[model samples]
Target: MFVPFLIMLREGLEAALIVSLIASYLKRTQRGRWIGVMWIGVLLAAALCLGLGIFINETTGEFPQKEQELFEGIVAVIAVVILTWMVFLDAQSVAQRQSTTGAGSR
Candidate 1:
């Protein structure tokens, strides 16, 4: 219960931040109308993903032992891939800074 709640909270905040960034960018650039469309699309996507998550959780709850293990393993692998990709992407700014500083010192 708490785990799902915390996960949902974090995911929600992250999404809210994304939308905020998009909206802010659009506003600053005088393209607020386009951002409205983008936000609607994002909301639709988030709704779909949430529905899919709920469906997956419900369906997996009915799985038997070995099959459940397989499903769990698959989910874990996908999560690991996504997590690693995110970490790499997040560190990309640091890499840019490192390169910039390294060149400046020469």
Candidate 2:
């Protein structure tokens, strides 16, 4: 329960960060009027996602155990792959910075 909550919290924060950056860009470009429209779109998207999740949960109750397990396993594998990719990208960036700064010469 806590794990899902934390994951959702992180996802929400990431989305908010992106929205903030976009909003700032729009404001900087003097396109502030569209910010309201962008926010409405975001809200609509959130509602759609919520509805889809509820629909899936309500419908999946009748699915067989094997299929449900397979779905969970697939989700877990995808999550692991994405996280591994992020970690590798971060490590590569750090190595590149160190090399440029001559900190890795030693």
Candidate 3:
């Protein structure tokens, strides 16, 4: 339960970051008029996702409780593994950056 929430939080943050960057670029380029179109695109994408989710939920309504629990467990495990891997990679990169900066200072 907590793992799924964390995964959703991370994904939501990433999507927000991407959207903000694009909006900033559009404003800087004086193409702010297209911002409306961008927003429309965003709305359409969101709607599509919602619809897809509903369809999938309805389709899986007949799934056995045992199977659903197993699937959820598998997903949680995968999410944890992926999150751990990302943290490891991020730590490595940060360490490398610090070492390079330290060497430059020396």
On lDDT, the leading prediction is: 2
Clashing pairs in 1: none
In angstroms, give how far residue 104 of model 3 lies from its true place. 24
| Alpha-carbon local distance difference test for all models | 0.69, 0.74, 0.72
Tens-digit per-residue lDDT, 1-106, candidate 1: 9987986786677667556655655674467889769968997998999898799888865678899789878976776676566556545644665686674421
Question: For candidate 2, which ten residues in a row score worst on lDDT?
Answer: 85-94
lDDT of 3 by residue, 8-93 (tens): 89867755755665676567446799999999998998899899879988887556889888987897788567656655655565
Off by over 4 Å in 3: 61-106
lDDT of 1 at 11: 61
What lDDT would candidate 3 get against the real structure? Answer: 0.72
Q: Would you estimate the TM-scores of all the predictions?
A: 0.51, 0.57, 0.54
- Cα-based lDDT at residue 83, candidate 1: 56
Candidate 2: residue 100 Cα off by (Å): 29
lDDT of 2 by residue, 1-106 (tens): 9998997897777667567756765674568999999999999989999998899889874568898789778976876676566556555655776777777532
- Which pairs in model 3 have colliding backbones? none
A best-first ranking of the candidates according to their lDDT comes to 2, 3, 1
Question: Comparing candidate 1 with candidate 3, which one achieves the higher TM-score?
Answer: 3
Which of the two, 1 or 2, has more lDDT?
2
